[model samples]
Target: MGGAGNPDGPTLGGDDVRILLVDDEIDLADVVSLHLEQRRESFSVTTAIGGNDALSTFESTEIDCVVSDYEMPGMDGLALLRELHQRDQSVPFILYTGRGSEEIASEAISAGVTDYLQKRATSDQYAVLANRIENAVARHRSERARQETELRYQNLVEASPHAIFVHRGPNILYANDSVVDLLDIDDRTEIYGTDPLSYVHPDDRDRIDRRMRKAFDERETADWAGWRLRRDDGEIRHVESRGAPVSYDGQPAVQVVLRDVTDQRRREQRLEALNDATRELLTAETPEAVAQVAVEVVESVFDEPFVAIWSYRPETDQLTTLAVTEAATERAAAERNEPRPVDTVGGDLEMDVFAAGEPRVIEGYADHDDAMTEAFETVFMLPLDEHGLLSVASVEPRTFSAAERDLLGILARSVVAAFDRLAA
Candidate 1:
């Protein structure tokens, strides 16, 4: 809806355009309906006895546009027009009356008449009556675009990797490049006059109709997510689809954006599978079961048994090894399962990390004494829960920098949050 001039639309015919015809002369209103029908601009034509009747019809039905004679009984076209504008200023209204003076034309135009025509004029003189409707349709589209562009049209379109398009009542007036390239399609002209759903997966057709109806009725954005779409080559892919109500060629249908998310979806599916497998392992009732799950998760993320989980003793300010799981080859007997005070091996490491109430990275084990260096090379102490740290250790005698510390912090927070939720 943004960053562009008004898109020109084809003439309106057999369109779902609701037009209220207001005239005291029933015969002239009938004649006008006949011509408009041929043009197919208005799907339904309603005849009113006067301005009052026109106003009543408008109140009852969802009128798309209005047409009225200047002179009428009870209320004149000018007065009715002022009322209509007050009710809804955006709706298009054309004045068709015997009054044709330049002064009246200017006044009528200023009064918000989309177009003005004299009843005395012959049919040939109003050949562009259809054109007038078409222009009003274009203006309506411009208005809609004006509102949407204020949000993020380019960003939304750019956000999607797939093609995007718009389908008017009977024409395809717009398309984005990625969509064009995906179908191996040539130009927008190739898809013009084509049924938009013809490319849609048959399974999604019903949903598409429902979505379209909701969007049209509410005048809001509509979307169909992760629906299967078929390309010209008969290839099908998962796509997120969206459409907005827009005037196409002086009529209404939809402006649509399509995105390809097959690759992203696939990655998500894989991640989900990995997470599920890890969850199943971690749910073990025994420490042995927990160790296995921990090993798998650590292996997937790091190179070796660089992970050591601890249970916190707040009173003693100590970290005791609850268990040790290794992904890489182990140098010590993990089965010994001996518990040691965290401060003994890494002086004040557990207390410092806990008191910090956040993640801390120890760059060099040598920064501490021999006991700390002998315990581990480099340690990233990330608080797993309220008091404990899930220490990721490296045997290479290194230090964890700010960047690594931040990444570990996020991961540790996730684990802590999960545990907190479980307890809650």
Candidate 2:
């Protein structure tokens, strides 16, 4: 234990050490300050006359530790301890006075006082007082460090977007803030130490239970993807949950992280709906109708500005111009590069999309080859029933994404299906 030193003293960590002394007797504070100064201790000491003055001084100064008297005029030391505890439980408080009693000592200890000291007969006893203050300050620093570490851990768990949970044996001991928010629970207590499956939808519980059993028996990581968790509000949440064995409470436990895929699945459903509509148009009696439907589907569902459908003449097997709605606003940017009407749908590029049965994003068609630069700024081409390819041109470069490619493929499947229906 070390007593605080003078202000601007050489501290180990290059930070100032502050000690606050509170007592009604003005001479006592002066005497203690003088004894510590003579001892040449490493602390910056500040003095206060009474409880009111002590609290005011504490507010204005950075007091590492507080030493106060039990009996004060305005407020008692116990009340001060209670208030200080509320503000900072780690900051230590020492009670030293002539009125030391067993009852007072126990009460002070209960109220969060660090040390209780009795009045000494000789003035030299102030050295012992300084030593006790130092010990109190050291203990407070240790406690503050521990508290900060705990807070950092808690903040990490609470702030993570992925839901993290601790499950000991078969019970869920803790869930991160995201998990609580996902389950729509008000407090950690509501979710603690219960089987995670209790919150799982009945349809998914068996599979989840089996996975847990496998994890425990094999001591392997458990993966539970695409399960429905029933929320407190009675809504089912689609989530991907994973559990792995980790150390918790000095024993093996399951650590779980949950990722939400609700939006992804919703987008998939929308794609399917758009694909269904494209299928309907593909079967529409004639190639012209198929072209019109493809164009309409792109405009209506994809909200794309440009659409074109090319057809290869059955007799010649050469690409023939079908239908194209020249996007008025985007036309200038594309037209500037193409000196021609892009009238020729050459055999090589035409067969590429239809044969591959996949779409490609061509950025600056001119860069793809001098031949394509004639009419397209950027082009995404999807095949149509092996007869020809459906190519959509946009002035915007790289407008099509990977998901958009899947979307076009789905539309191509519908086109293939419609072609079969029309051929029949």
Q: What is the C-alpha lDDT of each candidate?
A: 0.66, 0.73
Clashing pairs in 2: 2-134, 3-134, 4-42, 4-43, 5-42, 5-43, 5-44, 6-43, 7-44
Model 1: per-residue Cα lDDT over 259-286, one tens digit each:
7776567545545645665465445555
Best by lDDT: 2
TM-score of each: 0.38, 0.50
lDDT of 1: 0.66
Residue-wise C-alpha lDDT for candidate 2, range 1-424, written one tens digit per residue: 1236433222234344587888899998888877765654466778899888888888787888888888888788888878777767778788987897899988987887889998878965676776677667766676677667656766887888998888765688877878877877888788787888887899999998887776666779986677888887888878898878765554667778898776577567768777678756754888677767777777766777677777767787667657665562246345566534545455466566666776766677745553344445687777676667777777656677677777777776776676667767
How far is each candidate from the true structure, as Cα RMSD in Å?
Answer: 16.3, 12.1
Which residue pairs overlap in candidate 1's backbone? 9-249, 10-249, 13-40, 14-40, 163-179, 363-398, 363-399
Error of 2 at 349 (Å): 30
Candidate whose TM-score is highest: 2
147: Cα error in model 2, Å: 4.3
